[model samples]
Target: MSLLFLLVAWSATVLSCALLCRAALAAARALPPAPEAAGDIAPDPAAADRHASGLTLYEMAYLSGGPHRLADVVLVLMAQKRRLLLADTGWATVVDPVGTDAVERAALTAIGPEGQRHIPAVRDALVGDAAVRRVADRLETQGLAQPAAVRPGIGGAVRLVKGSALVTLLSAVATYWTAAPGADSGQVLIWFTVPQILTLGLWAVARFELHPYSDWATVAGERRLPATTGSRDAPDAPGTPPGSLITLALRGPTALTDPSLRAALHSSGA
Candidate 1:
């Protein structure tokens, strides 16, 4: 490669790699502190009770698996309560028109005034319900979940990093093609590999750090979830049955331990 071409290639590599690092670091720093940062501080007994009391199983379902899981939990619970009928052939018919909470009301409305709807359709409709958004908003406000707005920021940063990697690759290819014959193409390739390696390394580290940024639950909220697998034990909320609490903790159609109910949910794509 000509001396000028080599300089340009290195400059592009360096600039792209630097930009990737900067974007990744900025996204990481913008995250809230570790969930356990306040662990050393003891909470007041009265306040702890109040906090515990305020967290219903519906909220827990949202924390465990986001809106879809919350919808599943509500549907199964309604079935268990005889407020809805779930047929093994993949249908849901409302047995009770009245709903005791916003999530239930949303599910009911999704089922429509006709009182019947496909289970998957109801679940899909409920996922975007205002009631479901309110549930997310509440959890975000309580620091139990990441804010919806924060997710797009990190997502956009990651996309930019990927774009930078692509730019580096294309620049390397162009430089390789433009080099004069008898130039050490292998050496040129090695020089280009440095930025590729840097980009891959940064992506690996970023993935490790950001793996826990899931759609639902911060670390603190995850810590509070009852073991949903292979266990049915969980505390019940007022006016909520123990069975309903168990179903909510399980978080989705998999929680439908009854064979018929599970079949019904699965058939409907739940």
Candidate 2:
């Protein structure tokens, strides 16, 4: 009867692990299809001069940087217009008293008291600000961003399921050894390994299946955005590309060489 109980626990845990994976996959599938960008930003010639085949700065940022790229957006925007200064100390200085828009206002407000405020401090303040959130949503609606996880509760559920598997495996092993004083427990302990193996396998599937949707850029954007790293001369342009201002959303001041342009793109530096 004790051996039978161990088998049942092992089988049930494995089955539950499989169900957890299946449910997660099914939930991922149930999410709405990736919506087309489709006039979500209402194109204006003055507000935008389209390139990268008509994608916006925000779109390019999404492509290169993910949703967290909003920090770059604020930094680049203020730096470009000479409203703020990023110093080597990872602190920001407000040069201009005003912000031109909601995103700008939110960023400016994020740097409280504005005397060389720390970078991480500013990021924490701005990261969850509602205005910043609105812009992020706009990028998503434009289809520049992948659909966000509509159901984010899977993470905790995953942890719980994994915990249950671990516990059941331990319990089975202990019960087996306790039931017999002289008998070897080696064969009974085989069941102990089953839950651990199943947990790893199911987690792998979930990682692969769910990653694409949760990322900020769609598959296309990730490929389309320039692959340049920091402070590198853009191979094609002299001085800087006018569109480089737009690129600032993803690349920051890295590509700019002109002292004025670099100053404008600066978020933080030595």
Candidate 3:
């Protein structure tokens, strides 16, 4: 290939690779941290009461599940506490406007003008409500729902890599243009590809190892939460009773026939 063509070709590939790598790295680094628990709560053979880590069911749902889960928790709690009603048709009727807590108040507001509406409708309506935000903010303050922030180091590294690639490409272009026609590019592509691939590989390894962010559960919560996986062993924690509120929290609406859970899960549409 002509030296100029080769120079441009290789620089283009290098620039593309650098930009793609930086974009991927930036996305990975920007992932939000998972919702966290106050502490390792009642796991295993301990009594159910022993599992209380100062977090109520609402807190547990928030810590392990996120906003929709919190909404689910509130709905079920309201029904159980006789503050709300869920119809058989997935319609949620607000039984009482006066809620004992902020979350309940949020749900009450979320179910606004509701003689009955599908569960998903309620969730959509509630998405950006101030009361919902307050619950999330409260959880964050309690060390539960940790959000992601822009990372200067990652951003700087991305900029540096991209800048270096652009500068090197510019230098190669200048040399090629200033030289005589028909100069050989030789194996310069190999020189560039090897290091670029290595950088991406290293970055992939680091990204996979660190962060591990999730909106549902923190690293600790992911390990501790009771799962319904059909592993040969028992759940890491104990099982919930068929009709218990915890069953709904851990297993979703189908686990329990509670009208409230069905109403919440369906209404929230999450």
Candidate 4:
């Protein structure tokens, strides 16, 4: 009966770990899609001219009646722009080239040894105008160019899932096997516990390697509105939208009372 219980516990723990790892992988892949620049209500001809002059204006504007969560949306938009430019404009070609061994060696020397050698293939694809058009079409279809924000809670949840995987694995091994401390069971437990303990210790030693706050700050920075030469207080001034979808959903006096709405407002600096 004890063995059966141990086996069941071990199985459950392993299953849980697997689930956590899956969740983390999914979260990593599910980063918010890039934000589409709203159709310039009045196209600034100068904006196009500026681009021609090699000046890029990364603007942040609050959509009328949209969510005030500027930070998350800004980051997504910046990432999106980079993806579009890199994946479509052949920037990769200038940085990395394909086919020629000499070119590859030169690139490796410039980018350092850790650079991905496969990047050259991606650059080659980008250089083809047809490929660029196809990639743009795919981005539109996938809604990857749409503006969306990532929430802090969601980010935290992803991190938790990643951390829990190891914990679950350890718990599984501990729950299983009947060997006593002095017996074979004890030996197996020691083997399992030692590695995890060491890992935990290493994590503590390298705690500074983790940069959760900086990551959050980076996301926030991406969303920051550029300073305008004109008035800062104007309604049309560049800023995050005043209200989010969640805020609009909770109509009337209850809007402030809704927990989710309140949380969104707090995080978004609305």
Give the winner by lDDT. Answer: 1
What Cα-based lDDT does every candidate model obtain? Answer: 0.66, 0.58, 0.53, 0.32
- Which residue segments of model 3 deviate by more than 4 Å? 1-51, 113-115, 148-208, 211-213, 220-236, 257-264
Clashes of each: 0, 5, 5, 4
Q: Which pairs in model 1 have colliding backbones? A: none
> What tens-digit string does per-residue lDDT give for candidate 2 at 65-170?
5544656666656776889876654677899968776667777888876455766667667768877566556655654454556333354446656676676666
Worst 10 residues of 3 by lDDT: 41-50
**Candidate 1 local lDDT, 1-270, one digit each (tens):** 434555655565566556546644654464456543334434322122222424556667787677778787788878888999989988899998888777788899999999999998998999999888876766665566766545544445555556666766777788778877777777767776776776667666766665443456655565555543212344443464444444545456664558888888889887
lDDT tens digits by residue: candidate 3, 74-99: 67777778777766556678777788
**What is the lDDT for 239 in model 4?**
40
Candidate 4: tens digits of C-alpha lDDT, residues 1-270: 334544544454444445434533443454444433435133433234222212112112221111222222222222233321122221221333222322222333433344332333432322333422332233223332212232233335434433643664545455454435545454444444443444444344324322231122222222232332222233322342344222221121123443543443344333
3 or 4, greater by TM-score:
3
Q: Could you tell me the lDDT of residue 260 within candidate 2?
A: 52
- TM-score of each model, in listed order: 0.61, 0.54, 0.52, 0.26
Best by TM-score: 1
TM-score (C-alpha) between model 2 and the true structure:
0.54
Candidate 4 accuracy as lDDT: 0.32
Candidate 1 or 2, higher lDDT?
A: 1
**Candidate with the larger TM-score of 1 and 3:** 1
